[model samples]
Target: MTGQKPVTIVAIGTLDTKLVEYLYLRSQILEADPSINVILIDAGRAAIQHEAITVSQPEVLKASSASDGSLESLPRGEVVATMIDGAKRVIGDLVNEGKVHGVIALGGSGGTSIAAATMRELPLTLPKLIVSTVASGDTSSYVAESDITMMYSVVDIAGLNDVLRAVITNAAVAIAGMARGYAVRCATPTGSEVRKKCVAVTMFGVTTPAVTVARQRLEEMGFEVYVFHATGAGGRSMERLLREGRLDGVLDLTTTELADELVGGVMSANEERLTIAAKTGVPQIVSVGALDMVNFGPKDTVPEKFRDRKFFEHNPSVTLMRTTSNECRELGKRIASRLRANCVDASAIEVWLPLKGISAIAVQGQAFYDNEADGALFDAIKAGLDGSGIAVKEVDADINDPKWAESIARRLVELVNSKSKG
Candidate 1:
């Protein structure tokens, strides 16, 4: 089930246009490891004749359940969508049938889009790489919430040339190494090697003190604590793990990403930050740990409307803009809605508020201290959950105070134990 299985690397591209380049890539992979098995998936829709076709366009269309003529007759968007669907189905079957160990795809904009979509359907631990002509730009679309690795094809992925050969050769070797390594390291553990009870905690620079203390205490109580930075990607990763059943409980302390998501900041985690734990019915302790500020990159990056607002220069490259009372209220209401939808078992959820301050710069005499904003957030949450039966507690201590951190750790332990009993 592990390395005992031979590594099979699936190479996907438009063999119609790049048959010579595809052959060169295959040669490089064989040069790296002669035993490595390679499968060619032709995802092109054009009716170009090519002799080196392994998995033909007709096969892709059949797997995707699209009419053979749709690729040529349909609009370009529809054509690409159908091809992507076909690629996903084919890749899924290959993995389930033990024919695919890793996936490597190379192409331009259209090819990259199709390849990335296919790679995203694979498991998180699978070795998925995309060598693309558009890798250096905004890759959020290509790697939305997946573990697909992308490499910039310095030169275009055109026909074989001296420069193209070097890029494709390097990519081939990299994928080969990735496939071999994944096969060995990704086996499920057993016996005493099994993991301890896991807990997910959120962290940001402003809330590090509290999170660090809570994490240490949780580990002391025989639990494995994973602290995800409150960046967009970090929150997404945490949610992904929760959905995968990797954690037993959650300590969603640093919810500052909500502010960014609501107010158009750079580090927003969308609206799904606290939804997964609630949906899974996992025991959770939520807090407004760092909701006082929205994250932005550089002082100049702040929008014109926010330029006059209270701003803290977090570092040379980062700026923290204080959220307004209206924004806090909106955030609180949004959070409550998520909790109501997902946390159906009210007894399993607890919302804690730090009365003194929410983050490092929000305490009295600090840069982000805004009593009106803080009060609005607190009142909004209380009103939103007036009859929801979820417990809301207020602490007079600052969020980073050792006493507050200790209390949070203890409460989470209690909730985890109670859920385990149920």
Candidate 2:
């Protein structure tokens, strides 16, 4: 304990409005662990002077490069944006310096937004907790893809009541404990002397077998595999990790999210999907798995225009619509264009086509079976990559066939090996 670095916990809030609450929270944190260094950051719009405030609102604004005048003069939206930017900068610096072990915040919508934005900028392993009045509602905007823990405040975060006090105390004590444990973990060295190569694999329910086979093979080859579902959020998360340079190789076997993006499916991962690996030049083995259908929430949720389109009720909540030949062609072109325009090294990328079927339901006699559509997709991809150096291979088997899956996995291993050797 004598030579140990003090565990640091950052508490962010709108001090001008919740000064009493923040002070009480700080007291509780320090009381829980006196050795924990707690830094209170004021992210309020108005300037406030308080001895307990470690970082003032002006300092936050200055960090965001918005220190032209008092925060009170800025519009509410602009102020919140500036505060988020400033807090991220401040907290990011602390993290870079290894001073932040944990982060905790309590607030209403504005406070939650600022604190959550800042906390999201920190590492996923670092502990982040937020007590919010709106935690019970849809928190997708607030939490996003980060691992920030959110607890609903039974009452408002205004003047502290018995319930509010209990929540704040619990949050403070929890963060302190987490910070101490995080500090200890950071100090401890991992048992493995050599870090294993990590691969990011994309999957969907339709392509589970393929991903499962590939994942097992990668692990057997002493590689760590992160399998991300092809849902919108999952795809976005995988792309974020790829951009952060957290993965060595990619097995993009389930590209159904692109069909969702090309069509009007709810599971679209947006335009940025599939571009990161190409731009970053990570060894990738891509396939046309699960591109035969677009996803919808329910049978009724399918648009009236698509009423005549082929449909499969995956479940009571999910409906899958078969993609038309035109959509498939467009989707293929998009994928090829993205890779061709962004790929830094063509040798590191390979596209595999499962000629028999791209998804579980696209085989012969299946609900989504459509030879014309599949042919359109395959042809478009080949045409788009005509002059590109990227390799394109075709296999006469379903995407989920064990043998085909194993072959794709082996090819990925070969690519990674070649990259390492080069």
Candidate 3:
């Protein structure tokens, strides 16, 4: 498909409320490319409020009803949840059935929520656009872990006036251009025998040496490594690809997000970060890379609850706190449970515990140093994995040491190659 090729440009909105805006978009798309295919999808629950536009029902029907009653009568939260689920199901069906090439929507709060849910179900590469009034606020909820683009509707989605008309027209043209441009570049990949196997790696600033070294080694060994920053979204996206079955393997170096899980830090990947490789059954290499400290924001951003914890400043923007022995115990327990659950024969998966120190700053007399704290973490892992069959090779080197990095890279290569042979 190319810009010159006929493409599906979805014209979606409450044809009931903004049939004018929807029609205007259809005109803009036609003006851009007369050979384009425009799809009118009715996602609205109620009958369109305007004169009957003879709109047809969607191929995938999504019923958005809340007891067929007034807002006061229905539970608002339940209504939104129901609509979100229906929209996602319908959109998934459309994409799976090869119906929609590109998607465009103009909506308010309800539209933003519903339309975003639908777009979120589509893959990251697809062309998605939303001309929304609520694009101004915390769109994190609607855009969570997806690549849906949003444009602010300066004027409301009510009856279109001069300002409304300009915004809507520009949005439509932008979406049309996206569709055409994407279509133009839609040729199938060639058999160049150069399929770059993508591997996802997690890293934080504290664990720079290990991540930097491992990335270089992996690339040298003919693998493309994607380094995720271990922030809330970064870890979430790493797990998302793991579930989507996109990774050849995973090197979960900086488990700092696990810190956020143990402590109440801002960049919490929670329990999900530790188990992605296990769930996906990928060639996974786990490490206690940056578990020495939990992540937080500015000094004051440290929750009042954790104000008494020992803190170190990575920079003015980043604050780090050493984990307590008790916290380390829980973290080890959590990690062990994941390893045990993902236990496999042939010993492909392993966790390397750098006994000297886990992070650059955790070595003797460094900012995060506390042998007692380190001892607690080590003991917890030993006790938790008493007989789980998960290998725990304790090295006498600090985590950033050359030997530790080499071991990790060497073992991962062996595991991946073993799987390749099998």
For candidate 1, write residues 1-422 as lDDT tens digits: 33477788999887777777888888899999988888888888774555655678778878896556456669888888888989889889998886777899889999998999999878788889988899999998899778898989888887677888888888899999999888766454565775688999999999999999999999999999988998888898889988888889899999988998999999888767889888888899999988999889989878898778999999989899999999999989988888988886898899999999999999999999999999999999988888898999989988999889989988999999899899
Model 3's lDDT to the true fold? 0.75
Q: In TM-score terms, which candidate is top?
A: 2
Give the clash count for model 3: 4
Residue 116 in model 3: lDDT: 87
Ranking the candidates on lDDT from highest down gives 2, 1, 3
In the order shown, the candidates' Cα RMSDs to the true structure are 2.3, 1.8, 3.4
Q: lDDT per prediction?
A: 0.87, 0.90, 0.75
Candidate 3 lDDT over 1-422, as tens digits, reads 44344677765555656677788777777887787788766555454433323233332233433333322344656655555555566566667776566888899988777778878778876889999999888787888777788999988898878887788788878887887777655644565777777777788776778888888888998888889988877888888888788887878877777778777887786556666677656788787777888888889888888878899998999999999888888888777776776555426667778888888899998988988888887787777777766677788888888767767876887877777787
**Candidate 1 residue runs with Cα over 4 Å from true position:** 1-3, 47-54, 65-69, 187-189
Clashes of 2: 0
Candidate 2 lDDT, tens digit per residue, 1-422? 45789889999999989999999999999899898888999888888898888999888888987657567668899999988989999989989999999999999999999999888778877999999999999887888767899999989998988999999999998998888888998998788688898898999998998889888988999999999988887888888888888988999999999999888898888788888989998999888889999999979888998888889999999999999999999988998999999999999999999999999999999999999999999999999998899999999899999999889888898898888888
Superposition TM-score, candidate 3 onto the true structure: 0.86
RMSD score of candidate 2 (Å): 1.8
**Whole-model lDDT for model 1 versus the true structure?**
0.87
Candidate 3 regions off by >4 Å? 1-5, 49-76, 161-170, 184-186, 192-194, 344-346
